[model samples]
Target: MNKKTLLFTALLVFGILQSGYTPPEEGMFPLSELHKLDLKKAGLKIDQKEIYNPNGTSLVDALVNVGGCTGSFISNEGLIITNHHCAFSAVQLASTPENDYLNKGLVAKSKEEEIEAKGLTCRITDSYEDVSNRVLGAVAQITDPSSRLQLINNTMKNIVNEAEQKDPTIKAEVSEMFIGKTYVLFRYKTILDVRLVYVPNRQIGEFGGETDNWVWPRHTGDFSFMRAYVSKDGKPTKYSKDNVPYTPKKFLKVNANGTDEEDFVFILGYPGRTFRHRPSEFITYQQKFVLPYTSELYDFQNQTMENAGKKDKRIEIKLATRIKRNANVMKNYRGKLQGLRGIDLIGQKKQEDAALAEFINNNVAEKAKYGNLMKDIDELYKVINGDANRDLWLSQIYNSTSLLAVSRNINNFKTALDAQPAAQKQGFFDQNINQVKQALSNSYSSFELDVDKTILKRMLNDAAAFSPQQKVNAVNKITSKGSNSAALIDQFIKHTFELSKLKNQDYVLNILLKNPKSISAYQDALLQLEQDLNKQIAALKPEKDRREGLLNKLMGDYVNVKEKFLKKDFIPDANSTLRLTYGYVRGYWPADATYMKPYTTIKGIIEKGATGNPDFGYPETIKTLWNAKDFGPFAKKDLNDVPVSFLYNMDTTGGNSGSPIMNANGELIGVNFDRAYGATINDYAWNESYSRSIGVDIRYVLWVATKIDKADFLIKEIGIKL
Candidate 1:
């Protein structure tokens, strides 16, 4: 069949299914809604109270939001388990040539041996309450979009303030769900003294590396362990030698028996974002323009880092975390773009939207409320399509330049200094001095002049690619002279870096500390360039804000109307909110004649090892142990070998990495790290047939900790279960 025929067939099948279609039990549903689902029918073996309880500690209490990734307590002593990639930044921060944790790995044999994870923090949800009535009441009278937004913000701030005043140690925020249809207040206990406990070498943790990322039948370990410490008084406190290991009220029990296909499973984590309910125009704009544009920018970044890393190991160490992050995003976007086409997402979304439009038009009151919503939203996208591209390019350019970012930090301090009262000027200057010092310290620690030069040059050239109507004059002027050629841009970068005060440590320090007055104090070539770019953004801010306000108002109205019209408990889009998604342990058929098993065993690792790529290669000791057929008790009896990774039909996204995948009885079964390439489309549309979350099996984690690393203490600490 031709492409169009296949799409038409698929659409027909989908429409037929829709008549009786149960919303796939595949959603990141809020905890409160768990009671609404028939747990027995859906294969759940545990009660909703076991997972979440506002009055008492439950499974949710064991989960931690770790550096934008999810983690869970595995021991009462606060041993936390998360993905290696999730802890990548902390590992990278603690790494150096003489004692590179990334290369050699870490094993804190005792509590005293554990090193602090600087600038890392974890929070456990203390409570989540519905506050929709209160929030809506506060903004009921507001009509103007800006005023409405301001009132909502103020109300949320007041709510948060009251909650915080009750317990200074807790952090609270009010988040809107279903757009503005619902509001929830989440309170969390912030733990600051996180410590590195264990991390495997990259050869093991990041076994498949970028090549095998988001692919199926993976061998990547992708797991790490850390510990949270509290003050001697047993309260969350900053890193200090006086701190003791935190004792979490609850923790997950490891189930070493592993799971079979169709076994009930669930995931609890903060899913970053999902556009499943977004309009077709939004999806089309992203597929056609945004993804391709950002993908190219990421490609440039990856190549530059690779080129620079080959010459300097320090560069390799410094850029390892960034390169991995960029590559993941690039590949995800590419996969999503392809998946959207493969499923004819735009076509499907348009059909659904058209049907909904018809439904709205058929009713008089509904017509008055939502008749023009889709049309208005489509027009909004058209108005800002080119601007979106330009904004993304500008953002990439600003972020890629280390010196520019540093300069902006200094400018922020200057702004703060000027904003303070005259009597409080000295106190303000003193308070900000430490911040400036830390900022400079952090900037230089990972900053490589040569790498930044390469990025700056490439960014300028790419920025020039923006159409004349969308182009910024500063970028255009620089590129027009060189015709956006690499060599000319290179020369410009070299000259600018050499002449800029930002190049010298003493000059940067002098400007940042000597005069806490204005950004004008820094008469640097790089600063001038930054100022020019800032001017362009400043000039566009008013129009941008106006457009954004209109879009938000329209979207909010659309969501409110749709939720009532549908008469279903429609969950809001994921916005880094804690959520739970459940499914069965299952594999999928990605194509016509191929069916993949739910799990991959140690034997597959040996088979892939023959490829000889560093990503596929295993550590020598691990290989020897596997070769000897040394299957420990952690090995699955059915498989007769340890399961390395497994797949399940659970919904997940970026921030879901490191989430603990639990079995029906709430035992820790795996650590979610990636989704299959075809499943990338789940962010937009979930297809149960293809969508699956891949996780490193808990048995593999145990085997590695006991047999390979011989982390006997950790194994004993967690205690075994089957």
Candidate 2:
């Protein structure tokens, strides 16, 4: 009962909390809790230490955080496997009309043929340490919530800065595993140069497109391969022709035998975020506002991109990645919205919240400490919900995928440059000029003026229609009441783009070299608009900070009291940290009278493609190979064909995409990609019956790699000899 002890050690000792429950729940269990679970009893043929040995490298050493998604090393030469979509941006960036790697797919047989994945970096977890005491202790004497939160943030940043300064190739992040309750500092080996090694054509990689995305009983070959490289001297550096492949401490062995129904399976990867520990008020806000709003917003952006892509092949290629990304999240949000309602999450949570209240009231000291906690949280969310519309609109306008979003960023930088005193301004410019150039470089590489104008106009029109209470002043300034504001928005957008120097990167950089007054005076319609709206946006921030700070402090104490009241500590929520979640390879009834099998095969792919819908279409080579029955050892005898994908009830979220699913002996069975649509509600609550994740079978991966794509070297490199 030593509450002050480190969370990792405490949770390990307590063995998953409740008196009756010795095993952790069906969710992402942190590394420390791994020893408590009986892997052998759960059909694991190998010792648990093989997956994660904190004292040294284990299977966890092979895992890589590829951009936002996860990947794993499968070859001693750092041949990494991940989701195709995870590598889609890099492919898109490298593709050109003359040599369109995306459309035809890139199969770099030799190291010299590998293309640099622009701006794509891979990070491996080096180590982590608990820093909760230091973080919370720094704010102990501060009574003001805002100041307390500020001090806590500063402490975390200082810790990360200190850890990072020790080595140039290592960066550290302080994750708040349980908001206010637990914090851990994770250090990662930063590999800056990653290269795209192999990928199937768009037809095979994104087989069903949005139609089959996030749905179960799927046959999408959503997998790809990449490689990590370092300087010849074994040091990470920027992409260079002289670089060599990285040799990992551990790599997963590809077991194409695949898994049978009810076989034990586990996944170790970085899951992004979850809110299972959130209050009913938070659930209510997500159900009512966040999901629906984001779904519609992303849908609109997808439609806009589709409309633009219809013009040409080059444009289509350029827009493909954006469309896939927007539509993927767009559909996911819609599914989550349906799930949130299906579960009646808000109602269920309220009941538990009431029980919590009753529990607090029953105890004298608990009542004194947590009497106003629920009420305070509810009030905080009330303010947040009320302003959600205004904030959402502003967020879109200032942070869209268009160049105008870049303009807002550059404009803000310029404004900050202008605000500095004349003496200090030169130093500020010298320090931040590279940041400005980097933003321009990243955004303008894919900038489109027509797209920006259309997106900005629509965003403004939407903002102009806000209710009187939430009216946007900057939007209202250009349009009159009782009239069509569409024309006004278009006009404003036209003028802004015409006058914005943000488009002229060289000109802006030259302007930045001058005095602070020069930077201010060089402003145009776009910068001025951002400035006006930011005044309103900035004005709202203090209140948000005050409310958020209070919640942070209160939630910390609330977790302790709640743990005490429940007589068990709830498993921690996912916060983009490494975790292990396991479940058997079994199917579930998606609905009444509908039982989904755990596996999908290549026949399903050809069957669906026969319909002739573009999404279902695949390369003719696949059909020819299937017709000829040209298969290899990867084929399952019972299925009489290669298994395409399978579903398991593994608890996962967005960042888990590209995670390698392992069999009992830690052999790679598949790469975890999508979750069943029913599992969309997983962020708020995970019902074991509904939370099933889909993965591309390792058999299918080698089948396509060896048979169709003729990547024989890959088979030899992985040592499978398929």
lDDT of 1 by residue, 68-173 (tens): 9999999999999999998888898888888899877898899888877876899888888899899878867766766666677688899999999988988999
Give the residue spans of candidate 1 off by over 4 A. 1-25, 418-424, 477-491, 505-507, 510-520, 564-567
**Residues 1-722 of candidate 2: C-alpha lDDT, one tens digit per residue:** 12332453354335535334333346798886778778776667887888889887799999999989999999999899999989999999899888898878999989999999987999999988999999988988897888888888899999999999986668899999888778899999989899999999888888998889989778888999999999999888999999999999999999878887767799999999999988899888888888888888878877777787787777777777777887888888899988988888899989988999999888889889888888888888888888889877877675564566665677777778878887898899779877777876777665666766777777888888888889898888888653778887877778778877677766765664355566656756776677778789788877767877888987887778878978987778998889899887867888898888888888898999889788898988888888888878877886798899998888999899999999999999999999999998888888777889999998998999998899999889998854
lDDT of the candidates, in the order given: 0.82, 0.84
Where does candidate 2 have its weakest 10-residue lDDT segment?
Answer: 1-10
After TM-score superposition, the amount by which residue 445's alpha carbon in candidate 1 deviates from its true location, in angstroms, is 3.5
Error of 1 at 293 (Å): 1.5
Error of 1 at 318 (Å): 1.1
lDDT of 1: 0.82
